[model samples]
Target: MQWKQNLNHWLHHLPENDPLKIELENYQSDDKLMEDCFYKELEFGTGGMRGIMGPGTNRINLYTVRKAAYGLSQYIKDQGQEAMARGVAISYDTRHLSKEFALEVAKTVGAEGIQVYVFDKYRPTPLLSFAVRHLNTYAGVMITASHNPPEYNGLKMYGEDGAQLPPDAADVIIDYMNEVKTELLIEVAEVKQLEKDRLLTYIGKNEDIAYIHSLDSIKLNDSANNKDLSIVFTALHGTATETVQEAFLAFGFTKVKYVYEQCGPDPNFTTVKSPNPEEADAFTLAIQYGKGNNADIILATDPDADRLGVAVKDEKGEYVLLTGNQIGSIIIHYLLEQKLEAGTLPKNGVVMKTIVTTELARAITGTYGLETMDTLTGFKFIAEKIQEFEQTQDHTFLFGFEESYGFLIDGFVRDKDAVQAAVFIAEAAAYYKAQGKSLFDVLNDLFEEFGYYIEETHSITLEGKDGAEQIERIMESFWSNPPLHIGGIQVVEIEDYMTSIATELPSGMKSPIDLPKANVLKYKLEDDSWICIRPSGTEPKIKFYFGVKGKTAEIARNKLRKLKKLLLQGVHV
Candidate 1:
């Protein structure tokens, strides 16, 4: 009944001839669909608002975009005239309505007397982060869903540092968003008027040139011969085309080939079932191209170009897709080794990763005498650490990555950067090829040196209000019961991040976890394997992460399968 009231309010406030009004009218007869869209306002999570594109309070549409932009405008204005003068930089992806939503944000913020800088075309999410810092803007916004389905689109806000807004800043914006009583009543200025008033500016070629030039700093072996290393790159119908092309050229990667079918912008992602490079299927075209050309390595970036996936040839001459963990470990080893050889390795170097990522990174960093620290699940938290290192000077930030295909090699861009990763992955490939080895060989060697580390992620999707309730119930169930053994391995430690406490099993000794509180649980077994369960922050899914180590790949895979089966058997929708 309350959903009906909310639906009626939208129908009344929206213009009779508006497209959303007609769409809402058509869906009103479907009770289930209507309730799901009108039951509540779409939440502005720590990363920002994301949802399906539709006509309800819970969907992403013009009015909701206006509401979010207005909230950001109010927050900027509260920071004083200087903040408003600094303005916000905005960019979008290849998704449908992405550019339109970006313009809507510009107009809404401009209406509040705030300046705005918008890209002339859709660009990578990291470039938007670079623009915020490059232009000294007060904030930034990226219109993208990252690697979500075609039906999904969302907006992610960035702080001045170009990282996703931290929790405290996000909370302020969420409070401002809640203060708005009527989304439909939010006013937006005309793009023409904003341009005439000089409140809006379009950024393109110059900014891109600056971004590409910055890649020079991340290149560890520019002098290494790259012509012999052939690479296949696929942008997956996203935004990495121009940047990746220029970057490879700048780095002397002359033998690179592009998967033209998936290079340009396609809102539907017609070339692949999904645009996510993390999925093996997304590399379908790249693999064909790789085999035909006998390429040394293949790389793919998601729609927003913030994450990368790599594939390399194994000793058997078969192409093997490397997991995010493996790619990160190889990069870490190459970076430290090259730096040490050149006598440029910093004494206080540090590598940052998420708690859910593989521990092999720690093993690698430890050997180099570099510190390895764990953050929560988001790259934003790692970005926050980068900012802290700048102020403290106690540690020199070297690299940061998460298990979900995201990586950041340099702090110039506060978010994960596939363009940077692409350059480095290729350089590493070339560097290894000179020694008569493949990227796959390098990964195996690292495993041989640091034990076999395997990681897997499983997700369960549940939609609508009922689905939300079910997720909460599942989290509560795990919190209350605290399993004693998983896969028959004795649990040695139980960490409840939600409670910010870690209890040593059997001993019952408790210690505080000096990290931000989140709804996550981690179980450490006596055998050095670990499992983490947490609700997805950006999607309608709950994810389970499992990691294990062994002397060989076969043993590690078997242990991982057992861990997944036994723990997942206990979780229910």
Candidate 2:
């Protein structure tokens, strides 16, 4: 009955000729659909909000976009006149309605007399983050759903540091968002007025040049023989093709080829089932191109160009997609070895990875006498560390990555940058090729030196209101009664990030966790295997991440499979 009343409110306020109005009218008779759409307002979390695009309050649309922008605008205004003068930088990806949503954000923020910089056209998420600091803006907004399906679009907010808003800043915006009575009543500035008052400006090539120019410092080797490395790249119909090509050219990588079919932006993602580079199917076209071109490496970036997927030829001459952890291991080893050779390796060097990331990073950094720190599961936490290191001058951030294909090479861009990763991958490939090896070979070498490290992530998708309740039940069940042994391996310690405590088995001794509070749990096994469980902050799913190390690849894989099965048996999907 409440949802019906909410539906009626929308029908009463929306214009008769509006597209959303027509959609609402057609779906009015569908009770289940109506409830799903009007059950509650779309959630704006620490990373901002994402959901299906439609007319209802629960869906992401023009009104919800405006409401989010209004909250951000109010938050900026609270920071005083200088914050208003510094303004916000906005960009979008290749998703449907991305450009429209971005323009709406600019209009809404500008209406509050805050200056705005809008990209002339679509750009990657990292570019948006870079534009925030590059232009000295107070905040930033990216209109994108990253690698979500075509029907989904959302917004992500950033701070002055060019990273996703931390929990404190995001909390203030949520408070402001809840004070708004209705999304339908939000107002925005007209385009003509925004331009006339100089409250809005469009940025393009010049900013891009500066971003690319910054890459020069990330290079560790001269890499004059760039022609030795052949690379095949696909943007997955997203936003990184031109920028990646430009960076490659600037870095002297001329043997790069693009997957023509999936080169440009396509909201429908016509060539792939999903635009997510993490999935193997997303690289189907890229793999074909790589094999045909006899390329040494294949690269793919998601719709936002913030995450990268890599494939390399093995000994059999068949291309196999490398896991995020594997790619990261290769990059770290290359950087550290090259740095050591050049005598530029800092004694205080540091590497950062998420808790769920492979421990191979730690082992690699340890060899060079560098420290490795683990953050919670988001890039924002890693960014937080980078910021801290800057003020304290404690350690130099060499690299940071998550297991889900997101990586950041330098602090110039405070988020995962696929353009930077692509160039580095190319450079790394060339450096190895001159040494009579490939990336795959380098990965195998790392595993041989260190033990074989394998990692996998499994997710259970549960949608709708009932699904939310089920996720809650699952977390409670695990927290109240954790297993003493998983896959027959003894549980040495259990960490509950929600309570910020780690409990050692048997003794029940507890220690404080220094990281920020989050809803997550990690079970450290007697062996070098661990499992992490957490509800996805951006999607309706609970994810399980498993990692294991053994003497060989098969041993590691078997251990991973057993651990995953043991825990999955207890969780009801």
**CA lDDT of each prediction against the hidden true structure:** 0.93, 0.93
Q: What TM-score number comes out for model 1?
A: 0.99
State residue 244's C-alpha deviation in candidate 2, in Å.
Answer: 0.5
After best superposition, candidate 2 residue 562: deviation in angstroms?
Answer: 0.8
Q: What lDDT score is found at residue 477 in candidate 2?
A: 94
Which regions in candidate 2 have their CA more than 4 angstroms from the true location? Answer: none
lDDT at 566 for candidate 1?
94
Any residue pairs clashing in model 2, and if so which?
Answer: none
Which 10-residue window in model 2 sums to the lowest lDDT?
Answer: 220-229
Query: Candidate 1 lDDT, tens digit per residue, 1-573?
Result: 888999999999899999999998987789999999999999898878899999989999989988898889998999999999999999999999999999999999999999999999999999999999999999999999999999889999999999999999888888898999989998899999999999999999999999999999988886457888899999999999999999999899999899989999999999888898889999999999999999999999999999999998888888888899999999999999999999999999999999999999999999988889999999999999999999999999999999998998999999999999999989988988999888888888898999999999999998889988989999999988989987678999999999999999889999999999999999999999999999899888898999999999999999999999999888887
Backbone clashes per model, in order?
Answer: 0, 0
